[model samples]
Target: MNLYYSFGTVLLLLAITAPTALLFGYGGAMATRSGVAPLRWFGKSYIAIVRGVPDIAFFLFFVIALDQGFEYLRHKIKCPDWNEPIRQGSDFVVCTAAKLPLGNAPQWQHETYGFMLAVLTFAIVFGAFAGNVLFGAMRAVPKAQLETAEAYGMTRRQVTRRVLIPQMWVYALPGLSNLWMVLIKATPLLFLLGVEDIVYWARELGGTKTPNFTAYPHGDWRMWYFLGLLVFYLAFTKLSEVVLSRIMARLTHGQATAGGEAQRKAAA
Candidate 1:
């Protein structure tokens, strides 16, 4: 019961976090498309820097940097009167009260913290790819539609809400669907973040060398575990493609776009 519960928790975390990351990525894309120069620069720089770096490096760098940053702030606040160098021999030592997940916390606490970090890392990395897709899709919105909305006395925000945003999804769906597929594949990286996910537990429980291993131990089984993960991802991608196709059809149903016109002509 305990093992299955833990495994279920991990899957639930990924299911919730992946969509949240996609939302952040979509927001990042919108930010990059802003007319204000500084906002545009900030969003563009975020996407460019994230996409340029290798994901593992980003994971390592961000985790350690964020951990140290949190500790540093705590050190300042909790020990204002007593001063000791924080960096000693390339190790960051802080008061016992300051440790995240703490020295004597339950294993579950540590697991939860690691899962949060993995989600943040996934969001930042995937958001860059999403930004590229969304930026292009936003631009693909027809200018005449915006003008038509204005002719109806709609303001810029109203035009965006009523016309541009709704229409942009059809154009963005192809790219966003591709991004979802990539995100599904990237879930394995949760192992790198120290979450005892399916990958981690599989190797631990499946490997032969450990004396206390369960009855399923076999020699050199890493390949099989990885193969299982690959199939899961492939299945997930196919399911997403089906959902996206349905959404595309619904969104294009009444529009004058090529897809809608095709549907209309077919019906006639």
Candidate 2:
């Protein structure tokens, strides 16, 4: 049952992470193309820096850094009177009140806090990649379309909203679809984020001797549990592929792209 619940955790993370990442990506892409130099630099730097880092290193380092940052802010706010240095050799000390999901908090609170952090980390990392894809997609929109919109007396904002935004999706969908698959595969990394996801539960429950010494001691069932995970992921990827294909087809329909040409020919 715990294993079953953990599977749900994986799904929930993906559900939450996907849209959040896309939102972040949209902002980053817009920033990259902004007329303001600072905004453009920030967007470019965000994409370059995040994409250049190894994901595992970023995951390990960013979570700790983010947690500490939160705790530090809380410590200052909640314990301004305390004089002890927060950094003592290798340890980070803070007031009890500063602890997120405080030391005395329930198990669920700690888990929830960790899950939220994991979600944020995933969004930030994947958003960079999505932003790059979207940046390209935005540029791929026909310049003539923008000119035509302007010729019709549309404002730049109106041209973006009505012409550029609508057309870029056709170019963006393929790259975004690939990113979605990568994100799906990356869900197992949740275990490293301290989330008791399916992978963690699989290893924990699949061991020969249970931590509490189960009545039925089965030898190394890790293989079976992992096999189940494999099947689950495979089915998930296949479903995603089918859905993305349909989406691509829909987006391509009547567009100026080759996909649209082929689609039109098929209908004829």
Candidate 3:
């Protein structure tokens, strides 16, 4: 029941997180490589700080900080009349309207809010790695190719779009493939965010007490539950490898890379 549904939850989180993270990564990489000093510094700081932190620590702290930051801003806007400080001896109180998803929000709204936060946390963490990979990939595009595009009177932006981006993918795919696998493995962190994902259900159901614990009164079946997770992850990664390998081949087709050379040889 819940376990089955949680499988979809895990899948949905990944489906949303992957592209969002890539967008973040792409932006971060672009910023790092920007001509403007401010943009480059911002990008460098984001990559350095985010990548330097432990993922779990970032997840735990950032969610709380982000949630509070939102509420604080909303409190200033929506609860302007309030005279009391938001921080009072370890209690941060705010107006009802300021609460995310609202205090009286439906159960589904609460769950959805948590899920969104989890998605954001995952994206920000993984995107740094993706940014580093993409930045290197962008640089890996041959300087001569970019120079040729410029010699044809192409603007920097035009050269980037026509020459750099088109070719960077070949270099980027290998790193991105590895990042995708890492993202898959990192999905279980959803549990720490109180998302009631597959891992959460597994622990609850496998526990000795009741939450389905009473119904079955099962004795410590966590081993079996986790074993199933092991299988799911292994199979999923294997499938992902096949898919990404095909993508790499496509990107490398007729290019100057070793992969393209090998394909050309095989065809000959």
Model 2 Cα lDDT, one tens digit per residue, 1-268 = 9999998898999999999999999999999999999999999999999987788888888799999999999999999999999999999999998989788999988989999999999999999999999999999888988999999999988998999998898889899999999999999998898888899989998888754777776889999999999999999999999999998888788877788899999999
* Cα error of candidate 2 at position 251, Å: 1.7
Order of quality (TM-score): 3, 2, 1
Error of 1 at 185 (Å): 0.6
Q: Write the per-residue lDDT of candidate 1 for residues 202-239, one digit (tens) a residue.
A: 67654665546555545877777667767866787788
Error of 2 at 9 (Å): 0.5
Relative to the true structure, candidate 1 has a C-alpha RMSD (angstroms) of 2.9
- What value of lDDT does candidate 3 attain over all alpha carbons? 0.91
For model 2, the local distance difference test gives 0.92
* lDDT-based ranking: 2, 3, 1
The CA lDDT of each predicted structure is 0.78, 0.92, 0.91
Per-residue lDDT of 86-115 in model 3, one digit per residue for the tens?
Answer: 899999999898999798888999999888
Clashing pairs in 3: none
Task: List the candidate 2 regions with Cα displacement exceeding 4 Å.
Answer: 210-212
Model 1 misplaced stretches (Cα beyond 4 Å): 1-10, 150-155, 209-220
Better of 1 and 3 by TM-score: 3
All candidates' TM-scores?
A: 0.84, 0.94, 0.95
